[model samples]
Target: MDESSRRRFLALAGGGGLVAALGCRASGARSELVKPLPDALFIRHGAHNAETRLESLSPGQLVTPNDRFYVRNHGPTPRLSAAGWRLEIHGDAVARPVSLTYDELVTLPSRTITRYLECAGNGRAFFAELLGFAADGDPWRDGAYGVATWTGVPLARLLGLAGLRDGAAWVMPVGLDGDGYARPLPLAKAMMEDTILAYRMNGGPLPMDHGFPARVVVPGWIGAASVKWVGALEVSTREPMVPANTEDYVLLGADYPRPPPVLTTQVIRSAVCMPWPGLLPAGRRTIYGLAWSPFGAIARVEVSLDGGHNFTRVARLIGDDLPVAGTWWQLELEAPPGELSITPRAVDEHGHTQPPLSQQRLNDKGYLFAAPVPHPIRFV
Candidate 1:
């Protein structure tokens, strides 16, 4: 849809009871239709694109601001009404099927967690730039991930209230925005302590674009596992056969046969946030960036100045050491007058290091690019 038509749709959707459902007065203004994103945000690929610029990561709190957080929408953002919304928990494996309203969910015990949600296809552009074979999907850079403080009730708490029948093995969360946008998770992962039905982001009510009434926040997993605009959940006795699990998110490559292992936890990765192919004053310069891993906390980040050649430096971790999964690092060194290439590699607490670009596996979908990304720079 064109920009004007898109705006009109949003305006109509919001003014037409969607905002009222969420217990808010709908403003008759265009601004109420869609939240304006920051001007520096990049349009990686999409009709209604939402992505963060690499430079935006610097000089920000560890928890990304709600407006600056990256958004990956498979369909247009649905303007939902919380008052009319109900999360239905049902399936053959549920002992007591129940439908929960927004007010009822918020009255339950709540908890907060700071975690990063990263797209499995993040950094897919590096595949073509470095390996010469482009993946068939959104050509994302390193900005497809964002860290946030998510607040909600533990999903296990709700499942317990509903009573899971014996032999329940999978939990499938379905969205309200589009058809077949649901994904399933093993019961074990679904019942994890950090798995929550989040109604709030940062500190306020969840934004419409970020899954207003509620959404599932599956920590340490790929972003797809956390369904936005969550409306219902299906607890099944057998593995879910949804297309998201059986087709899209699974790895497919030459070595792996049909239906390779389904993607779960995000891979360890790092990216250079500064000095992006521009002239810089020759002297002392500090190269800084963000690094994260799903397995554990980032143990170390290595910076290579000349395309993994002779000079390599280990960056110093900044801020309080994160005992969890994500942190930032910075490296200070003298830069002589010349053009240069900078690359960063992160090692997680589990000893999993970022793979070199050449060592990355070739998947039909280009799902995960966990290799060190090279950034060009010129010292004047």
Candidate 2:
């Protein structure tokens, strides 16, 4: 990395720790200290918060560097020692409940996979900006997503050791943070080959903020499903309904009379990584960004300089085209010196296309805003 990049990386990693320390001092003996904002790598949403700036993600970058990876914590980041951590597997449907210490879990067969974890509320700001329909929750742009290589044991392997009794259905993973946050996964998803109990991230021990001892990794699903600081797994015969599932993560709108459907696999979406209100030199330039689909890989991406009125197919794709997750795409184009509106639309292998903001469904919680993102630029 160059000087500028290295500086940004350090600011993101080290600055956060400094802010955290200060926040703890200010709170003074409180169990939960607010997260401090970092000067680089992200924009602050709260005291214990940072979201990646879309422009920081360059074209063709595969694994999101751990320092630059975004942080999404529901509560304060817990300070837990790995040596004393244990993951308990129990509940109504397991024949033999088991508690595996951190060391014991790491000794099991391990597998690694590259997957992207996106907050379901990604692109929320677009609802108010583009469609004039504001909703509640974090007004995230497109930076609340990142792809990483996670190494750990398949969740199913651990479930097998616990021995699921007949009629076992849902798998609830609970975190170790404040008051404990938990989410449930269907038995099928929990047993999928890709789902894992990740202990290492990017070939290193998982970062404390990201889940130190262990966490569940449900590839291609909303980040909430892969609970961080996971300490227990409750294998149950009935669907698990916790606050994370019933009160949040489910869609609610005028169109639905009853409780809306829960958000599972993320919708197809794309974003341009250029600076907001960017100034670009006239003539030829290449535009770059990422496109992802929880159902499958992005099959095609189209770019439009004049908003969404007309689109030209992307000239090339720059990263691994993993059929089950996210990929980066780039386009080369010529522009005259003037104001320009750039938009990119993506279609996944599953035939899901990025919808226009006007046609998007409004949810009470402002989740899954997957429209073709509009980025403004000035050609100097």
Candidate 3:
């Protein structure tokens, strides 16, 4: 929250490192969710059909390899064809129904941006502190988040094409991704700046599991809002268009308390993406980590080499310029004078920050506790 602190965390190649769907009900099967490629990958803790990717990198590299980006799916991956897909916008709320074939949508308009996509449950297992119930879903570790360059058309433009009616207050996005499950976006967010309907990632067409033909990328929001393998968009006047769409990833019960009596802005958070235990140099060296904010541009990133006992500010670039989709700030620490102690902290423009995980009370879903998540690294 300090106006003076402006950097987050980082270690290096030698340092350490690091969904929901509720709609299957209240509606009949409207269409089929395309099946993913037979050979697609996933993370399953070496069992339960989960597959994982190991990422190690050099200095100054920020992009997580496309093939290695983490995957979080509620059901099986849906396979969609680029050549045969079309996006339709229609519903009682809309002034007029409109449809766009793949070619038509692309030719109308386009844009591109680089940002991080993180599953809301990126580090659920650590919450094992509560009742010993293993976290569900991918049982994800720190690697469940990744950054990439996404290219596509703006969702706002698409809404304009639909020529929305007065009753059209929101858009319920249903994907060819799963049967009958659709995510709803309030009209404002759906038409906001930078909200994208993407078909490409990192200069290439999206991978099969990532919505091969098309997907919605609502940067800085939880992954649920960015549905993949999209099939249809239904404009609506309803508040809870889909129960699953409204059931967001939330930290329930009392082990964790909602902030300011309202849990909306995601606190700044970071993790070290390099240096496995086997390769630690075993000496004095700097540590690395990444920090981010869902509220706005991260203006201050801090580090505590000794738990939360003390914090030091780090310096970064390409930040404070403006708030962009997937607002993130990168930082590095000097690793201290000797055997450095370290963990990164993120503080956004709104002044919210990450809490220490060790200090957080346990919760049922075990999420967004805002507790600081520290990644440890040693300098050999």
Number of clashing pairs per prediction, in order: 0, 3, 28
Model 1: runs farther than 4 Å from truth?
1-33, 323-325
Q: Model 1, 197: alpha-carbon shift in Å?
A: 0.9
**TM-score top scorer:** 2
TM-score of every model?
0.89, 0.90, 0.75
lDDT of 2 by residue, 1-380 (tens): 22353244333322333345436645765434233335557876775556787677666876787887878888777666676577878888999989887789999999999988888888888888888888897888888888889999999999999999999999988776654678999999999999999999998989877887788889878888989878788899998767777788888889765666887888888888876778999999988888888888888888877788777656477878775557888888788999988899988887889887668998878888888877998999
lDDT for each of the candidates? 0.78, 0.80, 0.58
Q: What shift in Å separates residue 246 of candidate 3 from its native position after superposition?
A: 5.1
Cα deviation in Å at residue 318, candidate 1? 0.8
Candidate 2 overall Cα lDDT vs. reference? 0.80
Could you report the Cα RMSD, in angstroms, for every candidate shown?
A: 5.7, 8.4, 11.8
Among the numbered candidates, top lDDT falls to 2
Instruction: Name every residue pair that clashes in candidate 1.
Output: none
Model 3: runs farther than 4 Å from truth? 1-58, 129-136, 241-243, 246-251, 254-266, 275-279, 313-341, 356-362, 378-380
The residue ranges of model 2 lying beyond 4 angstroms of the native Cα positions read 1-37
RMSD of 3: 11.8
TM-score for model 3?
0.75
Task: Give the per-residue lDDT of model 3 (tens digit) for 62-134.
Answer: 5656666666666555434555566777777777778777788778778988776766666666566323555
